[model samples]
Target: MKTPVVYVALQQFCEADAAPRQRLLEAGFEVRQNTLGRRLRREEVPTFLAQADAVIAGVEPYDAEVLAALSKLRCISRCGVGTDSIDVDAAQRRGIAVYTTPDEVTEPVAQLTVAMILALARNFPQHLAASRAGRWEKRTGVLLSEWTVGLIGFGRIGRAVARDLSPFGPRLLVTDPALSSGEAPDGVQRVELAALLAQADVVSLHASRPPHAGALLGRHELASMKPGSYLVNTARGHLVDDAALVEALQSGHLAGAAIDVFATEPYTGALSQMPQVLCTPHVATLTRASRAAMERRAAAHVVEWWTQASCLTPTS
Candidate 1:
């Protein structure tokens, strides 16, 4: 009998923690990792996981075409929360179980979100740049306590951000159709998207990619935001239209933007060129503890699924 193969497609997995990989080895499964040192190209995914029974995935796309090509793949356990990269419906049709470590990612992402908000509010980046250039430049910055911070989504990460920001005494506004009135936390006002955009001094995106085709924040929505306000996005890249955001920043309509994700990664766009925009390489959930927890959970999901599938199989 051939041993089941589990492909670890996540670019960086269990580098510090060996428990997750050890668990798979102990489970009588042959575990293989992505050797390319980067996200596998779309064409490379099928070839790389050709014999995999399960995959511990990252932000790689697993569309219908790729799903159809993987004859033996039974599961795709995501090391992170978002499912935007995967064609979930297609995987379901092919009987591939998809899993994500939603709980594990909350703390790290929320922490980064708060950090970005504070940095933007106090003009930290500009100050740093000035000091490095051999010039003493001091600029007035706003206090978070005096600001109205709007959250675009009220899910786990959003709620966490609200909790962290509450102590700073900011008026919180959230817009999420999924949450009812009772679901809102104390002192957090649940408002419509338009109202949140207009009233917020700092608007942070925590929402998932909308089901429709267009960006959640287009030209009109960006225009509606309070002039000289800031934008912080630690969520999905496609949530904000890149060109529109660049234009807003260029026009001095928006004070600044701290972007952690982009429509296309390895992102070299207009946002990068602007001094007002602060960008990170989509690493909101990349802390040491966060990565370990997510990797362990993702690996556990694969082991659990494989064990269940093995027991259900009829033996000769």
Candidate 2:
């Protein structure tokens, strides 16, 4: 009998370092690697996954149409925490089990968020730029104690960021419709979105992408923020209106922003030219520890599904 095939659709990283793939192969499975070296389009994914027994997906879209096209697909193992890329309802309807590596990425992302917050507060980028040009100008920076940090969502990542930020002695405000006052973190007060927006000196986005089609932060929210406030987003790019953010930055409404994710990734756009904005190539969770943990768990999920004929779907 032919070995079952497992398809992997990772675009940015090398699968050669993927320990999970090695584990699967050792367990007597055949791995069909990426069909293309770059991110595959929606049309290309179905053709590749049609005969696959299992798939380890990255940020590629796995909607109802793509899910329906996969006749032999048994399970989808996500490399990271976010399920926004996959159609969960469709997967459930088709009886295809879905799993994610949430626990793997929590600490690394939390560390990155704190790093960006500090970098923004200290004007690190501006200082570096001036030093590179042979200037010795010392830039003034805001102390974390004097600032209020607002978290937009109170999930695992948000909670971890809150814990890390606690040591800095900054006041914490969290906004999540699902979280009641009783559920707020220790020393962190739960508040309405508008109140958080109005009071925060540094606003960090940790919310999941809602299925809606409009900007979560528009002109009004931006205007409501304190002048010279900073915005940091390690979450989904669509959560903020890029155009509105650019306008705020250009008009000096915001002090600066450190953004790790974008609406259109591998971003080549006007935002790249802005001096006040610090952009990372969506590598907040690219640490060796995080990568290894996520891959191992995702591989284990697939192995368990095959051996026990059951799913390991995480609730939350």
Instruction: Give the lDDT of residue 58 in candidate 1.
Output: 90
Could you tell me every candidate's TM-score relative to the true structure? Answer: 0.96, 0.92
Cα-based lDDT for every prediction: 0.91, 0.85
**Candidate 1 local lDDT, 1-316, one digit each (tens):** 5799999998898887999999999998899999887788889999999999999999888888999999999999999988888888999999999999999999999999999999998898778778878889888998899899999999999999999999999999999999997888789999999999999999999988733456899899999999999999999888899999989998999999999988787798888867777899989999988999999999999999988998899777
Q: Candidate 2 overall Cα lDDT vs. reference? A: 0.85
**lDDT score at residue 278, model 1, on the 0-100 scale:** 83
Candidate 2 residue 256 C-alpha distance from true site, Å: 0.6
lDDT of candidate 2 over 1-316, digit per residue (tens)? 4577778787533433567877888867787777576666788888888779888888888889899899888799998999887899999999889999988888998999999999988998778767878999788898899999999998999999999999999999999988988998688999999999989999999988744556678888988888999899998888888888999999999999989988877787767777667888888888877887777887788787776553343434
lDDT of 1 at 225: 100
